[model samples]
Target: MKADGEALVFYENGERVGTVPLAPLSRVFMRGDVTVSSSLLGKLGERGIGVVVLSGRKAVPTMLLGRPHNDAARRVAQYRLSLDPDFCLRFSRAIVEAKLRAQAAFLGERRESEPRSRYLLTLSLKRLSSSITAVDQQATIASLRGVEGAGAAAYFEGFADLLPERLHFCGRNRRPPRDPVNAVLSLGYTLLHAETVLALYGSGPTPSSASIMRSTSHANRWPVTWSSHCGWRSTSMH
Candidate 1:
């Protein structure tokens, strides 16, 4: 990859593959064996275009943030609030409630078309509603997590009925997804995570320091890795 005036040119085995204009791009994601020129990197940085490099396994992600926000006070405030139990509890509860409601709504929408699965969908919806109530009533994060876990299990249990039989979506399996359905789910989650990290960096908040119903250790790793390479600070709530 190299820059030619205002466009980025791609090369493969010394042969020019194509060229892409930089004006329309917000970010660029590259993977596998690829060579990028210093001039292109400089131009990309100058244009404030982020580049994300995914590992060969396509699971790990490294981000190159362009023109990171220089707000020290906001970072400090986020760090302080992350450590507060009250803040974490309230924030996590609201996030879990919203998640459950969304799950219920999805199931409710599917119920209209799949009459045969209405019973299972209704059961999942009832479980999700109970989980939402539990989230509101629970004072501690641990209890709320339990409620959310139960709701997720119920949701996935009925997931197979919502899909066509040919898809073979037995359950929500990930971390080396066993089936095609799991593979797509894993890929979608990876993309969503990358997008979320970009959004957080663009908004001036540290992704490592933010957690909503996610394990602190697991959630902090991505931002830590990204910040280490991108020259950003890594701080966590836990």
Candidate 2:
């Protein structure tokens, strides 16, 4: 890719294929060995556009942040909030509750449509509802994670029932997703994470400030997927 004044031009086999205007762009995600010209990088940086590079089979991410937001006060407030355990617990609890409720609702819909899976879906719905009730009672992130984990297992129990037999999608798995269902889910999550990072940066607070759980490492990390909420996946990318 090369910068052409106000736009970026794309080439395939030495032939120009397309051009994209830079004016309306906020972020660019590049995967594998794609070549980007220095002039384009300069232009992107000048326009305060973020770039995310993904490499290797694991698709590890390297983020190139754009010019910082001017909302210093908001950023400072978010960082301070992140330090408060009580606040983080409350936020994390709310997130978990919302996720559980949504899962239950989805299962309820499927229960009606899939008579063969109704028994499994009913079991999941009951478990999810119980977890939602238990969310506020949990005082620590670790305990909260346990509740969420149980709920997720129940949720996926029903989820697996809804899938066609040929899919063989018994449960969620990743880190080189073993099955076709998991592979597609992983790809969707990776893309969602990139979009979420862009949205967070485009707003005010840094992605690190959005973290609800404490990391063992001193460095603050942002989750690469909503999988963290499911309690079965890694909380942050390495």
TM-score of each: 0.86, 0.87
lDDT of 1 at 162: 78
The reply for model 1, stretches above 4 Å from the true place, is 213-216, 222-238
Which clashing pairs does model 1 show? none
**For model 1, what is the alpha-carbon lDDT of residue 108?**
85
The digit string of per-residue lDDT tens for model 2 on 1-238 reads: 9999999899988899999999999888899788899999999988989888877886767777777678989888987877788887887887787777777877888799999998888888888889889999998888987998888889888888888889889898988888877777776656657666666676776776544445534224674124234332322210
Clashes of 1: 0
lDDT value for candidate 1? Answer: 0.72
Best candidate, lDDT: 2
Predicted candidate 1 versus true structure: per-residue lDDT over 11-65, tens digit per residue: 8889999999999987888878778898888888887788888776636668887
